[model samples]
Target: MKIDKGISLTKVELDRIEANFLAAWTGDNSTPFIVDAPISASLRTRGTAIVRQTNLYTLFQLCPTLATWAVLTPLAIDYGASNKNVYSHISVFTNKNFDDAQAREKLKERFRFAARRIGLPVVGNQPTELFFAPLGPARSQLPDMARAFVGAALHLGPPAVEDTPSARDWQRRAVATRCPNLTRLNATISFDRSAYCARRFEAWRRGNEPLTEAEALLFAAYDQAVIGFGRHRSDLVAPPRLFWNGFTLALEAEPSQSAQSIKLGPFPTQLPGGSQVAIRTPWPEKITWTAGSIAQDIEVAPASDEILVFDADSGVLLTRTALETKVIAVASERQVVIASEQFGVTSFGPSIQSADPGRFIAWTITGDELNFPGRLPPWDHITSRDGALDQCRLDRPRRNAYSFGVGWRVDPQNRSRCRRPNQNSPRTIR
Candidate 1:
């Protein structure tokens, strides 16, 4: 009854059973017990000796289910370190009734399945030289024999689905919690970059470092605009193209010291399809003028505490802000302006007499403040100069705003204008 050790069957008994079965089923002298019958008497004697010693015959006698099967023990020579060889002792059991062509096809199919399960490249019909390279440890190898046994068991009794968290579920939760603000700006962000940001945030939380004004602003933007409220809404509006345009302009501009002469404009004159041409002076006295003719003479003058933008053709002023800040401008069909102070990057739009004032978007570099407008701000709010002054409101107060940890800490030597708060101490914006 112990099947693992196998049963003993004499050659005479095996031959007799085969003869009886052949006689009863088909009137022939063929025997299914032997594979490739001997041609000469001497060869026949040698094959008979080999057959008696084989575990295949014993396996059949021990397990009645294997009676109609042929055993193929595939020996794989695995190479180890230092040119040493390690032999893999493996076996494959298949039906004996299968023809040469059927057996070959079956072997290949099994090999392909095993290769795929182990993340290996499969070859057609037979294994190629490329397949022989040792990919990993032999213990992790999925051979055809294991696949066959496991497949047969699973087919008979399939496993139930367990109530456990899957990879997809984890990914969904991560995307929802990490960068919800990005959902509105999804087209502008790459998945790799978002994942990287998530990792950075996690690292910052663990280390407890102070965040720079730019870092704090970007983090708050992702938190307020994306994760906190953006993803839940079905009708999310796209940020304005001008907002991004202005933001890009500010990002490219060289960082200047306080009260330094930073250039603001030499922006293109014409509107997208309009005839108006524009020109502007550099910082200290930031002024812009747009006219129909490029040859029109206009005197450029610097103003100490004001940033001015105007359309000379219509003699209409677009925007005027008197904040003590550094200014940078981008000119096109529409005017874009960026102003950076100790707090963060703030954007504003131009005021056209008949049109609504431009939108505002600001990212406060200081952690203590959160400015969420009743409406979603324009995308280009970070770079635009229009409506910049009206949008500079400290609506909400956040404690420990800049405490992301060591990775985001602003060096004290560079903290000339901005105060460096204690990393562990909570701070509030007025």
Candidate 2:
């Protein structure tokens, strides 16, 4: 009964069986395998292709992070530059690629994001003309494509577009938001001088005669865009106003300076003590003012530093030292409590005759010398209703005072001289 041993299945036969079984279970050409993954392998392959084949402009549209690498790669390979001191390439790429008016105007939205990331300086007045020559023939007309492009840009902040249109749009939005800090894109692009000069003269009744060529150019461009309406006479020609109608202009003059009559367009309710006005100086650009030559005083400096304090006469820089630097206000039966950095705190009562400084009142103080490891300073101390000087005192002088603990470092040269808060007052948590 030794029948011929059954022939073993050949490799081809085995493969055929496996294939047939798979087909029967899942259908031969059934929906192509689509295994879900975090990142699609197909997309990765496409992105690799884009990196190799895409142009510089298109590359930006696809991947903005490439901007860093693109500039780096060239300088690294050709100029032997390193990331530490390779600002030249960064500047060039940013200026040349991002600042092109025509390029930006086309991809305005994308350009806006790029400008923000790179921090472009602000130019006033003239609209940014991104394209020198039209992408198509109709340069003067606002094409549907351009409008759609702007709409799309507004929708997709950074991930979508990569041109000047985006940048200008962003700037407009920022200005509308009343954000004081603004940087311009394409700073090298000059402004329209005629429009700028006209607008400046209208506003201040003075010409920018002393402006340098560069400054003049920038101002000119800003005026043209903001005021000229890009050679059109439409309703959008005027620059956005920064003031509110019927707003009161208040003034509290310092005693040292003479009482001078102030003039603005239309006068609202007169500021009782004195109307507040801004005196802008030309050199170093300072602003200082006084109430009726003998009233309360406040002065802002050339460096834009401001000091608000009570003054019989704005004659000298007042300095008052206190036990705790954070004292704010003093309270008395008849007089109101007042606080100033220089005067500490004072209670002004009708009966009390002499003008004198008083005891420490409640206020907030920041501990500059507090060595807190892995922690930020108590900046939000102002939120505390009861004014308390936020001081950082140590429990054990040797333990937390000198060193904030295991993960702290004081300069080796000045380690001995470093002063730590003594155990007199404990670190106030509030």
List TM-score per model, in order. Answer: 0.15, 0.22
Instruction: Point out the worst 10-residue segment of candidate 2 by lDDT.
Output: 29-38
Task: Go through the candidates in order and give each one's C-alpha lDDT.
Answer: 0.26, 0.25
> What does candidate 1's lDDT look like per residue over 99-128, in tens digits?
356644554465444433322233444322
**Which runs in model 2 stand beyond 4 Å of their true positions?**
1-215, 229-430
Candidate 2 per-residue lDDT over residues 1-430, each given as its tens digit: 1111333434453344333322321232111110101122454343333334444454354343333233333332323234422334433543344345565344444433432232122122232232111011111211221232222222322110111122334334423243222111111112111122122222221233423222343334434443332321121111111110111112333222223332232432223223344322221111222223212112122111111112222222122212122221211111121222222221221122112222111211222222112222244221122323332211121111111112122222223322333444433331
Candidate 2 lDDT at 297 equals: 16
Residue 34 in candidate 1, Cα distance off native in Å: 37
Best by TM-score: 2
Model 1, position 116, has a per-residue lDDT of: 35
